[model samples]
Target: MSTLSFLLLFLSTFAFIAGGSAAKSWALSDNNWGLLVLTLALYSAGNLIMLRLVRDLGMGVALSLSGFVQLLAVNVVAFFIFGESIAPLHAAGLVLGIVAVALMTYPV
Candidate 1:
């Protein structure tokens, strides 16, 4: 993928991550309407950027890379921001997900 594509993907990924954070906050704060709106807006913007990415990098490759990156990022948000813990099994699963991404994205 091109550098531009990478940058776009990262932006969209962060958007999605922020949306997730907003969603969690919304739930925690008794379903705040503003946070819910922010969550939807972030996810929508992320998807729009992702649609551009599909043009730049093929859907399969783009989503595979994006999904893997999101998986790792969400874990970080879950841990540090949410004060969550990771078990050994979950770590193993994350490693396996990394392997799956590598296999999925390798040049044909």
Candidate 2:
């Protein structure tokens, strides 16, 4: 991938993490309108970046890479930033996800 595509993917991953965090907070709280709004905006931005990624890299590669990145990023944020627990199963799942992404993106 080009430098620009890498940057866009990074930004998109960050947006997914931010949006998921906000959504988690909103769900935990009784009512957090600010978080709700922030989540929506972040998710929208992430989607826009994802569109660009699909355009640049094609749907299969872009979606696979982005989905794995987002999954890992959100899990890390949930565990470290939000003090959520990560069980052994969750760790295994993450490892499997990484492996899957690697296989999917490997050059033919």
Candidate 3:
């Protein structure tokens, strides 16, 4: 990937992570119906950004890298911000996910 495309992908990934973090906050609201709407809006923006990045970079690289970035972001947020714990199984799953991304994104 070109440097500019890589930078865009990185920024898109960060936006996705930020949007997802904001989305998770909606779960705490008592009026749960609005939560779904708000979360969708946030996620949609993230997806749009991701789509643009993918267009610039190509699907295999964009998606695989984004997937790993997002997974790590979610895990960190879940553990630190949300006070959630990852069991051994969850950690194993994360490792597997990372491996899959690596394999898929590797140059042929």
Candidate 4:
């Protein structure tokens, strides 16, 4: 994929994950209408970006790459930003995920 498309995908994945986190927070709270709205907007924007990425990279590759990126990025955010612990098993799974993405995305 072109650098522009990759960057857009990265941003889209980030927004999507962040929106999920916000939605989780809202769900755990009594009232947080702002957060709910923010989540909806962010998810919508991310989906739009993902659609553009699909056009550029094809649905299979684009969605796969975005899913992998979102998985890793959300975990990293949870670990560092949310003070969540990463157990050894989780670390191993992350490594495996990276290897899988590498194999899947390697130039044919």
lDDT of 3: 0.76
Top of the candidates by TM-score: 1
lDDT accuracy of residue 20 in candidate 4: 80
Using all chains and alpha carbons, the TM-scores for the candidates as numbered come to 0.91, 0.90, 0.80, 0.82
Candidate 2: segments with Cα more than 4 A from true spot: none
Residue pairs with backbone overlap in model 1:
none
Candidate 2 local lDDT, 1-108, one digit each (tens): 999999999999999888998899999998889999999999999999999999999999999889878877887788799898878997898889889987897889
lDDT of 4: 0.86
Q: What TM-score number comes out for model 3?
A: 0.80
**Per-residue lDDT over 14-40 for candidate 4, one digit per residue giving the tens place of the 0 to 100 score:** 889889888878887887899899999
Residue 19's C-alpha lDDT in candidate 1?
96
Residue by residue across 1-108, what tens digits does model 3's lDDT show? 688777766777666766676667766667576666766776777788778777887777788888877887778888898898878997898899888877887889
Q: Give the 10-residue window scoring lowest on summed lDDT in candidate 1.
A: 98-107
Which candidate would rank higher by TM-score, 1 or 2? 1
RMSD of 4: 1.9
For model 3, name the residue pairs that clash: none
Model 2: lDDT equals 0.90
Per-residue C-alpha lDDT of model 1 across residues 1-108, encoded as one tens digit per residue: 789998998999999999999989998998789999999999999999999999988899899989989988998999999998989998999899988987898888
Candidate 2 RMSD to the correct structure: 1.3
Superposed model 1: Cα runs more than 4 Å off: none
